[model samples]
Target: MFRARSRTGATFLALAALVVSACSSGSSTSSASSPAAQAAELAALPEATPSALAPYYGQKLRWRSCGVPGFECTTLRAPLDYARTDAGDVRLAVARKKATGPGKRLGSLLVNPGGPGGSAIGYLQSYAGIGYPAQVRARYDMVAVDPRGVARSEPVECLDGRKMDAYTLTDVTPDDQREVDGLVDAYKGFAEGCGADAPELLRHVSTVDAARDMDILRAALGDRKLTYVGASYGTFLGATYAGLYPKRVGRLVLDGAMDPTLPARRLNLEQTAGFETAFKAFAKDCVRQAGCPLGGRGTRPEQAGRNLKAFFDKLDAKPLPTGDADGRRLTESLAATGVIAAMYDEAAWQQLREALTAAMKKNDGAGLLVLSDGYYEREADGRYSNLMYANAAVNCLDLPPAFGTPEDVRKSLPTFEKASPVFGEALAWAALNCAYWPVAATGEPHRIEARGAAPIVVVGTTRDPATPYRWAQSLSRQLSSGRLLTYDGDGHTAYGRGSECIDRTINTYLVRGTPPTDGKRCS
Candidate 1:
C-alpha cells in the first residue's frame, strides 16, 4: 500500500525505538473575507443546521473515564450515509483531555495524525493529549475522533494475520508474468475480503464522508467553529472540511499537506520521487557514519542508492530468515517497506543504518522485519491492525485507481523508474492494488478554495518522503486563506518534530489565532 504515514504523534518513532533495541537499529488567500464577515455569512447559511442532520448535531456526548489518567472517551453517532438520513448511524470513538487551564479556555482543539486509517483517538491518548505544548494544552481541550471505518470505530478488516502476512510478502517488483499474476491476485483477494467484510461501510469511507463526520463531531462538542491540526493524509481531510464549511474553519494547521488537484497517477509518481529524495538524504548521512553498509565516507548518494537497490535485488532472489514465530521471512517488499518507514523521520536514519547493517552484514533480517511490522502495525502475537485495510478503503474510494490494469502499470514503469530507480518499480506496482478495488471512486482531483474560511496554516518539509513539499505549495496556492510555512528539513511533517521555529509559529497560531505571515520559511 502507498502510505503517507503520520509523523505528528511520533507513533512510528516509538515503534522504531523498540526495533533498534532488537537489532541495534536505531493555506492561501484569494478570499479577502474578514473573520467577522465570514462569521456573519456562516450564521446565514442554512446547511449549517439542516433538519436531516439535526438529530446528529443535537446529540450530546456522555464522556466517562477511559482508563487513561487524564482523558475521557465517548461515542459519536453520525449517519452512515450523509445523503440518506434514514440509513443507520456509525458510532465514532472520541477522546479528549480537558484543558489544564492556567489560561482562559479555548474551544476544543481537534487533531488527526494522518493515516486516513490512523486512530485519531489513539494518537490523542498516546501523544497529543500529553505531548502537545503545555501552554496550548493549558488553554484548549485536546480532542480527537477516530473517523468512520478506523480504529475503535467499526474498523474495516480485510484479512486475518496469516493472510496479511502472505499479502505483504507478495513480490511488488515483479519480473515475470507469473510474479505479476501473483501480485494482482493478492490485491484482488484483499479487496474482495473488504467487500465481504463491510460492503456498505466501504463505500462511505471517502475523505469527504470523513469531513462531514467532523462537522457532526464539532456540533456535538458544542463548538461553533473547528480548531484543528491534521498531518499528512489528515491535511486532505481538514482541507475538505474547510471547503465544505468555509466559515466554520478556525485555527487549522495542515502540516505535511497534500495537493487535492493531482490525479492518482501524478500523486504516486511524485511520492515515488519524494522517497528517492529522502533516501538520498539518508544515504548522504549514512556514508558519514561508522559501519555504514551502503558505502564509506566518499560514496556518492547515487552510488549509495545503487548499493541499497542491489541488496533488495538479492533479497528478491533469496529471502532472509526473520526468526518470526509465524515462519515469515524478510522479502524484498518487506525490506523496502522497512526502509521507507524510516524515511518518514530523520531520527530513524540511525535505525535504518542499523537495520541495513544487520540485514546485509550479519545476515539477520529480524531488525528489518521489526521495522516493516511497525509500518504495518502488526502486533507480536501475529494480529494485524486495521490500518492498512482502512487505508486502502479510504484511498481507493477518494480517488480513481492509478492503474486500470497490469498493462497500465507496465506502460507506466519507465516514467515511475525515472522518478526513483530504487523505489519506483515497487511503488508503481503497488499503485495497482487499488485497481482491483471492489468500489469505484466517488471523488476526483479538484482544488479546495475554502473561499471565505479563516486563515489556515500549511507546513511542509523539503524532503518529506510521502508527501512532497511541492504539494504544500500547490495546496497553499489553492486555498483562499492559506499561509505557507516551509521547513527546510527532512521528515514527513513539521510541527512537534523538534523544530522550535516551526513549533513556535504553529503554537502561536493555535493559541492566539495569529497565523504566520504568508510565505513564511522556517529552518
Candidate 2:
C-alpha cells in the first residue's frame, strides 16, 4: 500500500490534466451534464441478483493441513472469464482457520489486508488469520485469498532483481531533457518487462476483475453473502465488490478507504500530500526527542522538512555506499523513497531518525536500504517480489493513466511541490510513469453507491501516509451505509496495528454483526 503512491488526490489532480487530454478525444455521449445528475445516475445502479451457487463450492476446496494448528488450505478454481463460466480456469489460493470455540459458527469471514498487491493469504496466516480476538475467531472462520495477479495467484513479474535495484535507485526528478528521456526509458522498460513476462495475465488482473473473483470465492465458501474486511487498496476492492454486488454485501469493513471517484493523477498527488502530513506528525514528535537529527530545541516540522530536502540534494550528487554483497548504493531518490516508506507506520519513525543520523553523521545507509527493500518486498537471496510490478499493473488498470507525457508532469510539479514541498518533485515524476503504460485503462472515476448494504465501517488515520484521511471522508460520504471510524493517530491502516479500541470495535462487529457507532473515535 505504501508503494502504491498514485492513489492520493494530489496525484489524481496532477493526472487530471492528462485525464483532460484523454477525455478530450473521448466523448461522454450521456445527457447528464452536471455532477449532481451523474452522481444520481450512478446511485441508481441495480442491486445484485441472487443466483443459486454451484454445488461444487466445497469440492474445489482441496483442504490440506496447514502449518498452523486447526487451519486448512484450499485451491479454488474460478473461470478466467465471469461472463463465460466455461472459460479457462484460474486458481485462487485460500487459507482458513476454523472456529475453535464451542459457539456455533456464524460464517466465513473473508479478509484482504490490501495492496491490490498485498498477499492476503500471507497476511491472514501471519497476522489477521491468527491474531484476531478469540471471540471473533470462535464464531467465524478466518479466511484470506490473494487477488488475481498477486502473490500465489499467478503472480506478475517485471525486471530481474539486479535490474529492479537499478530501477528503484533511478532519479525521478530530471533536470534536463536527457535526464527526462532516461526517466521515460525507465518507465518504458518497466512496462515492457511486465508485458514480456506476464502479458496474458496483466489485462485480467484489474480490480474489477478481482472483485468478480471475490464473488466467486464468496459462493465457493458457501456463504450466502460476502463478509469482508479490506484495508488501503483493499478498501477499494471491497467497495468495488459492493458496487458490483451490493445485495451480497453482508457485513463489510472498509478501513482506509480509497475514493474510487478520483482520477489517477489526483490520487497520486493527494497521496504525496498525505505523506507530507504524516511526516509533519513525525517531525513534531521528533523535536521532542533528544539527539533529534533535524533539530532538538523547539524546531518545527517545516524546518525538519527543509533540512531533509537539503540532505537529499547532497546525496543526489554523491550517493552513500551500503557495503552490502549486492553492492546496492543508496541514491537520493532511493533514500527519499525509503523515508516515505517508513512514514506509513509511526512505529518505524524512531528507526527513520536513526537512518537519517547514520546517513548524515556517519554516511551509512543500511537502515534506509532495509526500509526500501521492505517496501519493494525484496527477498534475502537478492530476488525481488512482484509487489511493485503488480501494484502498477492493477493501479494502471483501476484508473486511467495519471499523465500522458513528462511535459504534463513538468506542468504539475509546482502544484505537487505546493502540496508537499519536501517530496513533491519525486512524487510528481513517479505519477508520470503510468502515462507510458502499454495498455489503456478500462476504468473511470465514479462514486460507488453501495446502498442497501449493512453498516460498513470506514477507518481513517489523521496522519496516514498512504490512503489520506480525506479519502476516507469522501468514501464514507459516497457510501449510503458507511460509518466513519476515526483513528486520531499515525499508520497505514488503523485496525490491529495497535489500537485496542479499534480492535475491539471491529472484532465485535465481525463476531456479533454489530457495527461500531458512526463517527467513533479511537486514539
Candidate 3:
C-alpha cells in the first residue's frame, strides 16, 4: 500500500530501544554549551549564509489576501537545484494567519506536523491557525510553507488513481516466487511512474534541499531567525534546518523527533516494533470491551495479534469486497496499512475496533477500505492527492533505498520479523519500495549537530510509533543546547495532543523565550 506520510493532527513515533553505554565514543559530539556560548557561536558565523545563496536570501515575497480569513498567501521562488541556479526555479506556496492579539507579538511560529509529504499549509489552515491555544496563538503568527514538491507546490504524482488502487493491492508478503516477482514488478512500476511524471524534480526533493528552502523562506518572511514546531518526519526537516543554519535557529520544538544518525534499515525496524507496541496497547483495551473482534475477556494480546494475522492471510488468499464503487477490494497490504495507520493515534482506536469487528466478524471490508483510503488520500470520487507520490520522492532521494532487491529483503527478514511478528513481513517488503527508485540519493545517514542553535525543546512520546522516544533522547543529546521534554504516553506526537503539561512547557518556551528544564518529565 502507498504509505501515507500522514497529516498534522496525526503521525507515528516509536519508543526507541535504548543502547546503554558508559564511556564517550569520540570527539564529534562533546558536552553541551551554555546559552551565552551557543549564541556567540551562532553570531560569529558569517552574516551572509554563502556567496552562492545570496539571490535566494535577497529575493522578495509578495503576499496577498487569499483563502480563509485572516490569512495571506504568497509564492516563493527558489533554485530548483541549488547547485545549478541557472537551470531554473521552483515555486513554493506559503500561507500565514497573523496572530489575533491580546498578548505582545512574538514574530512567527512556523508549524509542520510531519510528512515529507504532508501539506504544511493545510495543517496551518485547518488546525494550527485556529486549534492552537489562544494565548500562544494571540502572539505568534501561524505560518506554513509547503515544502517543494508537496501539495500546492507543484506536487509529484506517480500512479493515477486506478494504477494506485492496483499497486496498493499488490501482495507485499509474497508466499512464493510468483508473488515475489509480482511485488518486485509493482515496486519497479511505481518508481518508473514517479520518474516519468517528474524526472527532473524527483531528483531534487531531498530533505537537505528542503531544509535550504526553509532558510530562504525565513529570509523572505523578514524573520532574522526561525521559530518552528516540527513533528514526525518534520523533526528531521527541522533538525536539518538547524544543522544547515544553526545561527538562524530561534526556537525549534522537535516533537516525535527522529534520530538523524540511524540508517534506513534500523529506522524501519524500530518503527515496525513500534507498531507492535501500539497494537498490544490496542489489544489490551479491546479485550475489555464487549464484542471485541479479535478476542474477548482474558484473551492475550499475542493471541489477538495472531487472530489479526489470520485475517490478513485470509484476505491474501481471497480479497474482500469493499463496495468502493471503484471496484477496489480490501487486500492484505491495504488492510495492514490501515490498521497500522490507527496505531499512530489512540483516539482512532475505537473506530479501529469497530472496523476490525466489521471486517473480522461481519464480513464487510468497507470499514478497512475507508481507513486505507484515508491514509492514501484517495477521495470518494476516485481521485488521489499527491501525498504518496511526494512521500516516496522525498524519502527515496533523502537516502539510499532501504533494500537493494527482493533477495536483500529476504536476508533482512529475520530481523524485521523479530521487530514485529505480526506486521513484520509486510513492513520488510514495504521498505523495498525505494529499492527500485529512479533517482540517485542526494543525502546520507549523518548526525545533525545543530551546535550553535538556541535551547531547542525536544519532545518524545514514551510510546511513539514513527519517531521513537529514544530518538528524542538521542537528538536532545546531539544538539548543543537541546533540552528533553518527555511525554509518558502512547501516540505519535505529544504537544497539543491532550497534555496540559506539555502544552504549558512548550508554550512557555515559545511565548516567553524560556527553555524548559532539561530532562523534565511530564505525563
Candidate 4:
C-alpha cells in the first residue's frame, strides 16, 4: 500500500546513494523587553494565547549544544490535547543553528520537511542546518521541531520489525476474496497495533494539534511573528498554522503543496494521477536511454507503462529473490513501492532505469529492494524508523478514511484506474489502510483562508509525483494572501531541486521579505 509520505531532500539524497550502491544507493525571537511591549505583542498575536496555555507559551528553552556542530537542541512541552489543557505534557524535540550574520537577523526561520512523519529536527541536523542557501543561513537562525508523534518526539510505535516487514509485503492488488481479506486483515492489525501501543497519544496527534505546538514553539523562541519554509506534507502544516494564526505569519514558503480542501479520496486519486504524470515523464526519458528496460527509443509512454505493469504482474505470480538477509523477495507490492519512491525526484530516474534493467532483464532484485527499503526508512539492521507509523498516525487523524471498507475501494476502482491505469488498483487499495483506524478523524477537508497573513509564497512543481501541481494551485487560490510560484519542472519539491529561478525567487523572498509577483513562473 502507498504510504503517501512526502519525501524530504535528505531522504532523497540518502536514497540516491542506495540506488548507486544497490544499484546502488529556524529562527527566534528575543526575551528582554518592556512588560507593556510584551503585553501589546501578546495582544497583537493572531489568536490570543489562552490562559491555560500560558505556561507552555511562557516556558524557556534551554538550548544545549547537540552533537551536531553549530546546532543546539532543546525540548518544548506542549499539552497532550489542546482542548484538554490539564492533560499531561508531550515533550517535542527541537534543534537550531544560530544565524551567522553580517546583515540584520530576520528572526527565527522554522523548517519542516513534510512527512507528516518526517523528523523536523532530523532535517535540521542533516540538511537544512547546512544545505540551505548560504545567504539564508547567514541571516536567519535555522530551526526545526519534530512534530508530535514523529522522530525524537514522543514517537508512536505499532508493529515490531518482523511484523512490519510482513505488512510491507502484503499484497495490495487483491484478485480474490481471500486475498482481499488478507489485505484488510493487515490494515486491521496495523491499526490495532498502534492503538495497543499508544492509546492515549494516538488521539492527540492531529495536524491541528501539531500546528498548535508550532505556535507554542514560536512563543518560546521570542519571535513576534514566524518566518518559515515547509515542503510536502509540511505545506499543509504551514497552511494550517497560517489559518490559525494569520496575523502571526511573517514570511512563509510552501513548496510541493497539498490542497487541504480535498477529502482523502480525492487527494489519493489526484496523487495517483500525479504519480502517473511523473511516471510518464520517467518513461519518456527512459526510452531515450541506452538500456531502458520498459522500452527502447521511440516507444510511447503508455506502452512503457503497460510493459512495467506486466512486469509487476509477473512478480505478483512469482516473486524474485532480492538477496535480502531477511529472506524477503521482490513481490509486486515491494516492487511498486521501489518505483514510487524514485518518482519523488528526477535525479533518481537514471538509477531507476538501472534498477529496472537489473530486475527485469537480469534476475537480480536487490536494486529495486534498496529503493523500497529507503522509501520505508528501513535500516540495514531490520529495524524500521517511526516514519511509517507516524505517517499513519497523523494522516488517519487528519481525515476520515478514504474508503471505509474493501467494497468502498472496489467501487472506486474505475475512477482510480482512469486516473492511473498502472498504479490505480494498488493506490486505491492503499487508501483502505485508514479504514480500520482506531481513532475517529478529528479533521475534515476545508479551505484555508489565512486572511490577514503576510503574503505566503506557494511553490508548485508541475510534475511533483506525490503532491500534484494542481494542489499547489488550489492552495494558493484558497489563501487570501497567497502568491503562487510555479516551477515548470519534475520532482516532489521545487526549491533546492536545482531550478535557479525557483531558488532565487524563494531566497529573495525569504531574505528580503518580498514575495515573487503573484502567479510568477520559474524554470
Candidate 5:
C-alpha cells in the first residue's frame, strides 16, 4: 500500500517536530539578535560568484506557449549536480501564467505544494496558477518550476508498474518470519532498483541542491527576490532556500512547516502518533453516523483499534483475494496504506468506510486495493509513478535513516508503539525502510534560521497528520519574523480546500502583504 503523507495542518506541522521539551532542548545561549542584526548577518555572507554560477547561467531556455491559456512553458537548465556544475546539465520544466488586471505588478509568485515529489507544474496548472485569488494573480505572475529529481525534471523511477503493484501489496506488518523476510527483500530490491536506474541523479537530489536551483530560477525569471507559497514538504524547500539566501526572501509563506532539527526516527514516530490522533478523531465522528464500521457496534474507539489490529492479523495469516486478473491480494501492509490514504483528505472518509466495510465483511479486497493504488500512483496500465521512488530517494538523502538495523527498530518499537498504539508498529516498520538505504544522508538536523526574511506567514493545523501542529509553532518561533495562522481543523492543507477563512487570510497576505496577526484562528 502506498503511504500518502498526511495533509492536515496538524500533520504537516508535525513535520516540524513537536515543540515539546525534548525537541526544544538547550542550545548555546548565543546573544539573541534583533531583526536588523539578522538582516546584517544575511548581508555579510559572501555573494554567489558568477564564475561559480556560470554553468547554471550560461544554459539557454526554449520558451513557448503552453497547454493552459495565457500560460507559457519553458525548460531551464541546471547542473545535474550542483557541486559539479561543469559535469552536466538537467532540464527543469517551468510554467507561468502572467499577471493580469488593474494593479501594478509584483514580481513572480512561485508556488510549490509540497511532495518533495509533487509535480509543481501540475500544481500550478491545476490549482495555484489558475485558482489562486484573481487579485493576487493580477499583480503577480503565478510561477512553478519542477524541482530536480521530480516530475518533468528527469524524475527517478524504480520499479515498473507491474513490479510496483506486487511490491506495494507486500505486508509491512509481518506476522511471521517469511512475511518479514519478504518485506526486507522488498526493501532491498527497491533500493537496488533505484541505484541501478538513476545512480548519478539519486545521489545529487538533496533539498539544499533543490533550493539552489530555486535561486537560479529566481534570477532567470527576472525577480530580484523570490515570493513563494510552499506547502507540506515544500515548506522544507522554502525554509532551506531562506537559510541559503535569507536576504533574497520576499513574502514567503511556509504552510505545513517541517521541523528541520529532528532526525528521521523522531520525525517518523511523531508522524505515526499524528496518524493515531487523526484516526481517533475520525472514529469519534464515525460513531455519530449510521452504518459506522468501527463504532455504533457497541465498540469504543480503543476497542475498534483492537479490532482493526485483529483484522490485519487475520489478513496476515491468509492474504485475501483482490479479484484482479493478475491475482493480486490484500495483505496487512495494503490495508494500513489504504487507511493512511484516507487521512490525507477527510473527504475520502466516506470512501474509506465503504472500502473498510467491504473488506471486513466479505474478505473481498478490491476496494482497499484501489485506495492503495491511488496513493501509490499506480496507472491503470500498470505503470507506476516515480512518486514513491522519488519520495524515498529524497527523504533518505535529506536526513539519516531512522534506524541502523532491524534490531535498532526493535529497540525503538516500544516508543513508536506508545506514540500511536494503533498504527505505531506498521509506521515504525515502514520507517525502517531507510535503514537499508544505499546512500548516506547529505544533510543533518539544524535550525533553518531564516532570519532576514520579511513577515513570513506560517500556517499550522491543530490536528495535522503528516506535519504535527507543534511543528508550525516551532517554525513560527524559529523564524525571525514569522506570523502564525491557525487552522483549527482537519485535512492536509487548509488553503483552497473549502475554508473561506483560510483562503481569504492567505490571499490577503499574498496580494496585499498584510499577514494575518499571529495566533489568528480560522475554522
Candidate 6:
C-alpha cells in the first residue's frame, strides 16, 4: 500500500504484510508480545550485533540542505550484503527536519512510513517533517531514511511501464487452467524482469537488513538510542530493530502494526476479512446517506456486498470503457484493486462511492480507473512507480511463498473463501505472485520477543485492512515491554487520523518516555 499522502502526517506505512511467522529476527514471531512470554522472550533475543557489521556501525553521515525547505538530505553507504561488506555497498537516502523548539532538544526521532519500500525521505520532506506535533518537532529532529532498495535509495526495478500495465491487469480470479497458466506466466515475467533489472539488489532488501540500516542511521545521527515511529510494514521494521538491537531501542511507536507470525495466506485471508469489516462500516454509513448508489435506505450490508460483487463479475465478463486516450478498459483486476484501496482509510470512502456510482450505475469507468492509477502510482504519461514491484520483492524474500503451486492455492481456496467470500479468490491468487520469486526466502514464521527493549507503543485500527487490529494486540503481547494503545475506529493507522485521544497518548510517550496505560482505548 502506498502512503495515504493526501492526509498530512499519514506518512505511516501502508501495504499488506507477510503472513507467516518468521525466525528471520526482524519479522520473526512478531505479531504480538504477550506478558507470559516476557521472561522467555528476553532469553531468546539475538545476543547483540555480530562482529562483521562493526564497520557499518562506525560509518558517519555527511548531511546538507536538501530540496525541501527546512529539511536536509544526505547519502550514507551501507554494505549491500552485510554478510560480505567487502563485496559491494548500497547508498541510503536520508532526510531530516530539525525541531523548531522551545523545549530542550531530545534527539533524532526517526520516522518510517511503511511501504517496506516507502520513500522515508519523501515522507519526511512532504509530511512528517512539517506535520508532526509542534512540541515533538521542537524537542527532537524528525528524521527519515529511505531503506535500501526504496525511493532515492538504490531502488529495485522490475518491469517497464507498458509491461507493468499488462501485469497489473493480469487476472487474479482465474477461473480455469488457461487463466491460471496466464497468471503463472505473469508472475514468472515479473520475477524475470526484477532479476534482469536488479539482480544484485533483489536478494538484499529484506526487513532484517533494513533494521540494521536503522541502527547505522541512529549511530550516525549521534543518537544514543533509537527513538522512532513506524506504521504498517514500518511496524515490522521497528519490531525487527528491537529484536536485533533490543538494547538500542528508545521510545518507539508502531502504528497500524503488522503481526508477522501468520503466514502470507493467513495474512491475506485476515486482511480480506478486515476489508469486509471496513466495508461493512462504510456500507452501514452508506445506507444512511443521500444518493447512496450502492443501496437504498436501510439496505442490508450483505445486499450491498452482493451488489458490489455483481459489479465485479460484470467487469470480469466485459470491462467498461474508460476515458483514457489509450483506450484502456476497467478490467476486473483494476476494479477490484480500486475497491480494496479505499478500505485503507475512511477518507477515501467518498471518492470510492462516487467512482462506484459512475462505474456501476452510469457505465462510466473513468473515476474507478483514476483510483486504480493512484494506487499503482501510474503517471498521466503511462509510466509506473516501483512500489508494487518492491512490495512483491520484499514480501517474497522476507519469508517463504504463501502457496508453492496453483494446486496448493486450489487446496486453500475453501478456507480463504470462508475468510472473506467476496474477495477470497483475488486475495488468494494475489498471494501467488511471490511463489515464482527468483530469490529464495531468507526467513521463517517465528515470534519476536524484543526482551530487553524499553517501552514500545503499538497502535491498531479496529478495521485496518492491511494490518489487522489483532496484529497490534498480538505484537503488543509478544513484546517484552509493549504497550497496546487501541484505536477503536477505522483507517489503516491511528495516529494523525483525527483522534486527539490517540495523538495525545503517543505524544506523551514520545516526549515524556511515559507509555500509555496498557489497553487504553481511543475512539
Collision count for each candidate, in order: 5, 19, 9, 19, 19, 32
Error of 2 at 441 (Å): 0.8
Error of 4 at 147 (Å): 0.4
Ranking under lDDT, best-scoring first? 1, 4, 3, 6, 2, 5
Of candidate 5, the 10-residue stretch with the lowest lDDT total is 12-21
**Compared with the true structure, what per-residue lDDT tens digits does model 6 show for residues 309-396?**
8888899899999989877899988887777777778888999989998998899999888877877778999887666666666777
Q: What is the alpha-carbon lDDT for the whole of candidate 1?
A: 0.81
Candidate 2's TM-score: 0.91
RMSD in order of candidates? 6.8, 4.5, 5.8, 8.8, 5.2, 4.0
User: In candidate 1, which residue pairs clash?
Assistant: 26-351, 27-482, 27-483, 28-482, 29-480
- Over 4 Å off in model 6, which ranges? 1-52
Q: Model 5: per-residue lDDT, tens digit, 9-119?
A: 111111112111012111211224222223222112345646867757655566799877878999988888766777788788899988887799998999887766767
Worst-scoring 10-residue span by lDDT in model 2: 18-27
Better of 1 and 5 by TM-score: 1
What is the lDDT, from 0 to 100, of the residue 329 in candidate 6?
94
User: What TM-score, computed on C-alpha atoms, does each candidate reach?
Assistant: 0.93, 0.91, 0.92, 0.92, 0.90, 0.92
lDDT of each: 0.81, 0.74, 0.77, 0.81, 0.72, 0.76
Alpha carbon deviation, residue 207, candidate 2 (Å): 1.0
RMSD of 5: 5.2
lDDT of model 1, residue 331: 88
lDDT of 1 by residue, 1-523 (tens): 2344463111221111111101010011112322222221111133548888899999999999999999999999999997898989899999999999898999999999887778898889888999999999999999999989998999999899998888888888889999999988988998999999999999898888889899989989999999999998889889889988898999999999887766666666677788899999999999998789999999999999999999999999999998989899988988988898899889988888999999999889999999888888899999988877787788778767767788987888888788888988887777676677898888766678888899999998998877889889878887899999999999888889989999999999998889999999989
Clashes of 4: 19
lDDT of 5 at 209: 79
Give the per-residue lDDT of model 2 (tens digit) for 1-523.
2433212111121122211111111122122333222433133334443242253244456689868776788887766655555556678888998887779988888888766667888788877767877887888899988888778888888889888777877777688999889888888898899889877677777778888778878877789999988877778888888887777889898887787766556666677787789889889988899988888869988999999889888888898988768887888877886787777777888999999888888999888878777766788888876667777777776666666778777877888898888988887777776676676777777778777777888988887878889888878888889889999988777887889999988888877788888889999
